[model samples]
Target chain A: MLAHAIFFYIFSLIAIVSAIMVTVSKNTVHSVFFLILDFISISCLFIMIGAEFLGMIMLIIYVGAVAVLFLFVVMMLNVAQQKNQWFSARESSKHIPVGLIISTIIFFELIIVIGGWKYKPDLVSSMSLNIDSSISNTHAIGYVLYTDYIHIFQLSGMILLVAMIGAIVLTFRQRSGVKRQSYFSQISRERSDGVELIDVPSNKGVKSDD
Target chain B: MEYLSIIFSETYKILFLLVPVLVSVAMIVWLDRRIWAFVQKRQGPNVVGPFGLLQSLADALKYMFKEVIIPSSSNKVIFILAPIVTMTLALISWAVIPFSATQVLADINVGILYLFAVSSLGVYGIIMGGWASNSKYPFLGAIRSAAQMVSYEVSIGVIIINVLLCVGSLNLNDIVMAQESLWFVIPLFPMFVIFFISALAETNRPPFDLPEAEAELVAGYQTEYSGMMYAMFWLGEYANILLMCAMGSVLFLGGWLSPIDLFPFNVIPGAIWLILKILLLFILFALVKAIVPRYRYDQLMRLGWKIFLPLSLTWVVLTASFLFYFNLLPIN
Candidate 1:
């Protein structure tokens, strides 16, 4: 329990710090990186709570793909001018008042939430998995997904398919000058026929500009 | 007294395990330098200690004492947090790795899965570092690394499933024990090679180290890092290398098991054998890095996805069939 608490505190600290860094950093790339940090910390928190699958998915999908894509976009974007004056009077011109008001409201909200909170850690349900059972979490998850969550799973798949098709439609550009390979043609072509027999006549360059 | 004992036990374990890891990281730095020098036919860090063993320590101390130059133009918060994230994730992954029979921080049921999950988080640190640096080269490097990691990780995961099919357990101990009769290297030779290669790519070691290609990008995403932050990145890299090597040994070389296991030799400590096997694997890694030329970015991607992925997928099916034919599948 103590170990769990320690990990929770650490992850929360990291998440909060990274979140602030995302907005506070002068460099756009840095902000994107901070966003990656924030995502990772949250994922760690998920792992601490025994959502290992969710944590793994978060690491693989969000940190491995989305955050990276954002980093690339931010990196590629032009922000050469914002190099200096990062912490100067100019930053306050845009963010100071907004930051102050937001912080005040958040502080009040936190007070209200914390004041009314009743906290209790959930006990490990003995009935959840029998000790004599050899079936793993993956088996249980598979069973539940197939039976109870089948409809929702199908819906999600359909949504993904739609998105994939939409992406293909949007990016289907036909441009000239680029040579495209045909798998069918390549496979079907006979080596002899595919190889062109070229024999050019020699000494035909005497009649130049004249 | 009970609470004190618990605290003491935890502290003792942490100190004992962590000190070696720290030392190992230092030695890995020295090893990298020496290997680089040996390959190029020049001495590396011969000035400090015997064969430059103390050089890494000296360098680390220097980094520790040096000023952490926060780029005036950089994002202070993210820049600071990036290395910490990388190091923490790298260190945490080691918690589940069993060295021998007795040496392990956490003997979790899903040890292999946990390692995979935790190690996958490493790329985030690189991405964050690059993004936080607010530089073009680092950002480009980070993006490239992210893509490379994802592409290779698919094949790596697929290959792991092949091993799991044979071992019939996600537990590291079981995986190691399964190899007692014969190393997984014998039956799964192709998978072993693929796993090793993929691990190298995952760690961003040479040949696959497109992120830090000096000719193109000036130190890649780590361009802005200096002193201790830089050391932390290097240390984490080596630690990860060791971790992968340790895992590879356990998975393929039969962990700590000896070849001749008749009677008396069976009583010999498995931990020593495990370490020896891991060190051998690490040495192989070093040798390969020394010998191989860096692959082009396009070629790296092509090899990982078009070649390795399909190969691993095919092998998984083959392994499953073989297991079924032999009736060796774990009924559980």
Candidate 2:
């Protein structure tokens, strides 16, 4: 228990620091890298808490796919050269105080909620699906996911499918000048399509379509 | 005291496993070169040592002594961190990989998913390296890699679902154990092929190595990296290839199980069989690299999204239905 506590604190610290770095970094690429570090530490915290499945999933989804996408866009836009200015500009500085006030309020609200929330004594018993110690975390999730939460699972799949289609539809374009290989034309060409075996009267007199 | 003891023991086991892995990485590099040479009918690194067995070690030493050049425009911190992340992730994924029934580092419940997740995360190293270089070619390479890895990962995920459906468990040991009756390659042959191809693409191996297409990209993401930093990327790449081979063996090739349950074959330990299987798969990987032509970027994307994605998704549905209808789904 002590070891677990130590690991949790360590990971959470790393997570918090990296999270801050993600926003505060001057370079966009560096910010993305920090964001990845933030995700990794958070996932480490999750894994330390015995939610290994969720931790790995988080790593795979956020750090692997989403963060790479973020890096891609950042590099493509070449925003790393842009100097980060939070409140230096005269006009932009005016909104800094307001932003800080709102952020502080939100932060306090979150803290208050976390401090006030408590688990009921009977909460464990009242749960519909208790984690079975006999099975693995993945198995437990699958059991609940396919059974009681089947409809929600299917709905999420639908949502993903919709998102995929929407993305394709949004960025897809047909450019006029681009030449593409037509496999059908290439594959379906007959022997006589181009080969006209004519008896050349003489090398000089055999004129082609040139 | 108890926790300390556990940590110490775990560290020892990790060290034990890692030593062999590092040694094997060196050997595999040498072997890959020799095999490629054989395929091309040329002498490989025969002058270094007998059969050039010590070539990898010599190369490692050379890299260590060479100067690491950090480009003036590059993000120094990220440029360094990228290779470390790549190498670390490559080695860490081995934790959940069961060598045999009991020869694993961390035999967690969600072992397969853990492997999947770790393998998927490998793209970050390439993207970071590319972006950190702050060069045109490296950035282009990184973008290409990002899209390529992301596209193939979807299909790989779907293909794994097919195996999971049959096994009804994500545990690596259970998945391998379930293959006791018959290897998944027989039943899930198409999925196996798709998974292997996806694995190749995921690792940026031949026919799918558009990210580092030398003719255009000029060394791709590693354009700015030098010395040990460049070598680290190579190490990570080979480690990933080995991991993919191990995954292929574990998921479809019956892992540590011998080909036949004959007296002589069964005498060998399961770990040996697993190693043999991994070596076989590695050979296949090398052969594919030697033979297959590099894919066009558009064709690669088309294969992943248009072909593999639909194919693997359909296989998942078909596999589930078949398992359900036949009452063959393993009742976990």
Candidate 3:
């Protein structure tokens, strides 16, 4: 238990530090790397807390796919060296109070949730699913996800599908006057499509349009 | 004191797993080259050490002594970290791999997910290496590799879902054990083929190796690396290849199980069968490298997104429905 506590402290410390570094790093690429480090440390903490499935999925989804895309965009736009001076930019001042208020609200909401958990333990336990100790972490989660939370789980999936379709509809466009390779047409062309046989052309040495 | 001893024992076991893997990495490089040479009708590395078996070893030594020339304009930290990251991530995924019924480094419950996670993160190394070099070719190579890996990873994930559906467990050992009666290769043949190709794309092996294509990008993301650093990339690439082969064996080829249930075949240790399967897959990988031409970038993208994605997704639906209909899912 002591060792677990020590390791948790270490991972959380790294996560916090890297989370800060993600915002503070001047280079966009470095920021993305720091964000990845943050995700990794958080996932490690999740694994340490016996949520191995969630932890691995977090790493796969965030570090593997999303973070790579982040790096891809940051690298492609050649914005790695761009200085992040949010406060100094004159136009940015317009959004500062709004950002602060939103963040403050989120922070307060989290505090309230924690406070409620401590003060009203029964209330917190009311919604919690029964975790079977005999089953593995993955099996337990599967039971809960597929049974108790199936509707909400499927609703989230539907939301994601809608978002994806909306994104595609927003961005997809067709351009005219572009010569594109039609794979079907290219592959299906036969000898009959382009060849002609003439009988009397042999005597006149195949004269042009005669 | 007990904790200290436990840590030491864990380290010992880790060395046991890792040393063999690293050594095999070297041996497989030689094997890959020899296969390529044989396919082209030539003797490969015959003069080195009994059929040039020591060639890769010698190459490693040479790389050790050579100068690691980091480019002046490159991001030194990331440039160096990239190869280490690549090599480590490639090796780390092996922790969950079961050599036999009882032999594994870490028997985590979500073993397949851990492997999937680690393999997916492999792109970071190449992307970091490519971007940190701050050169046109390397940067372009990194971009190409990033897109290629991401695209194929989608299909790979769905295809893995098919296998998972059949096995009904994410545990690598359990997945292998589920194949006691019949190997998944017999039933999930199409998914296996798609997976094999995606594994090629995932590892950036030839035909799908647009990221480091020599003719166009001049070694691509590896353009700026030199000496041991370059060797690190090669080591990581080969290790990743081995990981894919291991995954293929685990998911489809029944892992360490003997092909025949009879006495003679079952007498051999499970690890040997596992290694033989990996070697067979590796040989196919090498054969493809020797036989097939490199894919164009657009065509490769089309293959991954248009063809493999739909095909694998449909296979997942079919597999799930069939399993549901036949009551064939393994109960973990």
DockQ of each: 0.35, 0.74, 0.90
List where candidate 3 sits over 4 angstroms from the true fold: A80-88, A196-210
Report the number of the highest-TM-score candidate. 3
Candidate 2 deviant stretches above 4 angstroms: A80-116, A119-125, A128-133, A199-210
lDDT of 1 at A40: 80
Please give, as one word, the docking class of candidate 1. Answer: acceptable
Q: Which structure is stronger by lDDT: 2 or 3? A: 3
Off by over 4 Å in 1: A1-54, A70-134, A142-169, A172-174, A178-210, B1-5, B262-268
Give me the displacement of residue B106 in model 2, in angstroms: 0.9
Model 3 over residues B1-332: C-alpha lDDT tens digits? 98899899999999999999999999999999999999999988777899899999999999999999999999999999999999999999999999999999899789999999999999999999999998999999999999999999999999889999988789999899989999999999999999999999999999999999999999999999999999999999999999999999999999999999999999999999999999999999999999999999999999999999999999988988898899876655
Q: Write the per-residue lDDT of candidate 2 for residues B1-332, one digit (tens) a residue.
A: 88879989999999998889888999999998888889999888887788889999999999999999999988788899999989998999989888778888888878888898889889988988997897999988988998999999999998888998888888899999999989999999999899889999999998898889999999999899999999999999999999999999999999988899999999899989988999998898888888889998988999999999999898888998998899987885
- What DockQ score does model 1 reach against the true complex? 0.35
List CA RMSD, all candidates. 6.7, 2.6, 2.1
Weakest lDDT window of 10 consecutive positions for candidate 1 chain A:
A118-127
Better of 1 and 3 by TM-score: 3
Query: What CAPRI-style quality would you assign to candidate 2?
Result: medium
Scoring only the A-chain of each prediction against the true A-chain gives TM-scores of 0.63, 0.82, 0.86
> B192 in model 2: Cα distance from truth in Å?
1.7
Q: Residue B214 CA error for candidate 2 (Å)?
A: 2.1
